[model samples]
Target: MYESFYGFTSKPFQLNPDPSFYYGSRGHRRAMAYLEYGLHQSEGFIVITGDVGAGKTTLVRSLLQRLDSSKVVAAHLVSTQIDADDILRLVAAAFGLPAKNVEKADLLLQLETFLVKLTAAGKRALLIVDEAQNLTPRAVEELRMLSNFQLEDHALLQSFLVGQPEFRQTMQSEHMQQLRQRVIASYHLGPLDLAETRAYVEHRLGCVGWKGDPRIEASAFDVIHAASGGIPRRINTLCDRVLLAGFLSEKHGLTASDVDNVVTEMREESGPERSVTPINAMPGLDSSALARLMADPAAARRLAEVAAGYQASRLEARVEQLEKVICALLGLGANTTDGADQDKERRHAG
Candidate 1:
């Protein structure tokens, strides 16, 4: 909603990771270097671990954007809790091979043949397993066994494992010795610092052609960094809210106190499911303007006029109801008089 107000061509703070808006912080650069190095080596496992929303998937997306699909047939898999045997089927399916209703031996043979064909054609197979922390030890071991596929001393498939921090613990298991020995590179992604947080926000805004219509004060960035703890996702969430608040208020620029008000409103909204601005939000007036409007003489008089109009409507309705009651009472009295007059005329005739 605020995107239009800010004249942005696109939403700058969306939660979905878009490699187009990928910002290279210090840590991300190092992690990307490792991933690139792994791609070059074309063997063994490349493990990447990070907290949720720490740009892990963004890194992968960025890498894929730069990949040479002619030489490498890449398959991306989001890991599930399937068993050892099922993992092989999943891998096959990812590479466009038939996985359903096929026997395990046949499935393995088909995958091996596909890889061998790719190798003979002067191509390689690359697999990226996402959310790999969910994989059981047996499932992981199966991945390692697939790495054993060899074509004349050259590995057939190279795998990249991306998961949350818990995957590191999974790799530490004693049963994982064989897999550990085969790991070519591993890196843990961390959150941005305050300086990087500011840079990231600006980078995303710049992506959408930000011209500073709603100029953000420097102190506002500080508030955002502190509230979001320098996490990319959290910063996105808070900054999006702040922009909306500013747009609703018709603000040309935002201040630190404005950010604080938005933060407090977010906290207060925990009670009920509420929207930032009500559906009937009006131009030149917003929720935050109530106090100021009440203080100003002109605005106060306008409000008083509105209140007076409402009271006048109620009074007019009451008067109309009283008039109807009076008419009903007058009609009953006339009917009684007519009945008496008729009875007297009958007596005289008798």
Candidate 2:
């Protein structure tokens, strides 16, 4: 709905991880270097850990985009809750190999043969597994065995394991010691800083061809940065929703108040207390917790403002309704250029 108004070619803040929209902030740059170094070395497992909404997947996608396909064979996999055998099968399937009903020995042999072929062709094979925190101890051990497949000088196959911070905790387990030993490179992708957070939002908007008077106000970014803690996914969600709020009000430029509404709305929907929860009541909070919460006066005001308007009986329902409306509007905005006609089918049906 706001795409043309904003002069964007597409929705700038869509949650989907698109490499084209990736903003290589300092932390992201370091993470990308870690991934690139791992690939360049043709080493064993390279592990990347970050919080849920951090840009690990985006970093991976960026690396894939720049990789020389002619000399690099890459496979990506998600949904990694399987057993050891299933893990190998999934890996094989990623490489377009028939994995069904294949025994472990046969699967290894097939993979080895494939690796040898790639090596002979002067190409490196890379396997990327996302959400690997779910992998069991045995599954990790099984993955470690793949590192054994190497020529005299270099590894024949490399694996990149990307997962949430819990995966790092998992790796620290005694059972994973051997696998950790085999890891040639690893990085913890951290959140963007305040400046980078602002730049990130602008970069994503620009990627989608935004050329209008910037819909997002400068003051709004401080609230966004505070609310989202510089997490890319959360930023996208909040920014996208704020745009909807602005559009609904027919505002050309977003204000801090617009961003406040979105952040407050998010908090109400995400938890019982729309404002600050007591320090002891919250888990995983440290000594700086209270200080951090109070540090951003604007964010505090936004949270308080939202909490003030939220009635216990109607909060959840209202939040859900707003979320649906916002999403529908965003979907309409996204469809304007590429698939506008296809979206018309729904209107025709209605």
Candidate 3:
């Protein structure tokens, strides 16, 4: 909404993980290096774990964007607490193979056949499992077994596991010894520092063609870094709202005070106190008016209706985003095709 006001070509602070806007902060660079090292080794598990909004997914997307499709075929899956059997099926489905209602043995056979075919075609198969923290021990074991698929001395498939910080602890457990032994590389992604935070914001802004029209004050960067705890997603949320607040107030430059106000409003919106209010307790409502509304059954019904509508709107938006992610994971969208083709197009356009 504020794009035109700021002369941006697109929304700079979107929460979605877009590879084009990826910023290689210090920690991200090391993580990427580990991932590249894992790819070079090409026959074991590569694990990356981070906090909820530390940009793990974006890092993976950036790696995928740079891959040479002629040499590698990649499949991505987002875990949802699936069991061991379901994990196999999900992996099969990720590679565009039919998996529904298939027996475990059949699913494994199909996946193996597919991987072998890719290997024959001179391409290695890569499986990226995001949100791996939700996977059951049995499910993870199934993944390890898949990694054991080999033609002679060559491994047919490689796996990259990405998840929240707890997944690292999960990997350290006694039950995960076999999986641990197979891990060739692992990196813990940390949040950006203050300087990286400033760079990150500027990087995203620059991607959308920002030319300093809506200038962000130096103090504002500190305020954002503190409020967002240097987490990329949190910073995106805070900055997006701050920009919107600036646009609403017709201010071309953002100050720390603007960020503080937006943060307060966000907290108030999410706070329990905002969820319900008695008619008499509502601010700016006179005692007599409150009494009149409390006495009128129609007024109470209208208020309930309004509240229900608001809740429904919020649910609808959440559902929409979930649907988009599901479609992307399933490769059901045109934009979700093989990364190689998209990368080629992106480079050609550039």
For model 1, how does the per-residue alpha-carbon lDDT over 163-277 read when each residue is reduced to its tens digit? Answer: 9999999999999999999999999987676567779999999999999878988666655654554567767777888888888999979986787687667646743332121
Please give the lDDT score at residue 280 for candidate 1. 13
lDDT of 3 at 167: 89
Tens-place lDDT per residue, model 2, 1-350, is: 87776667888899889898888998888888888888878888889999887888888888989999999999998855777868899989999998999999999999999998999899999999889898887887888898799766768888899999988988999888888888988889876666677889888887887765556666667667656666788779888888877777778888766776776666668685443212121222222432344345443333323323444457444433332333343333543323433433544576
Q: Candidate 2: minimum summed lDDT over ten consecutive residues — where?
A: 276-285
What lDDT tens digits, residue by residue, belong to model 3 across residues 9-81? 9999898899999999988999999888888887999999998888999999999999999998999999998
Which pairs clash (backbone N, Cα, C closer than 3 Å) in model 2?
1-333, 9-208
Top candidate by TM-score: 2
The Cα local distance difference test for each model comes to 0.75, 0.73, 0.77
- Model 1 lDDT at residue 129: 95
Off by over 4 Å in 2: 273-350
* Cα-based lDDT at residue 70, candidate 2: 100
Deviation in Å, model 2, residue 96 alpha carbon: 1.4
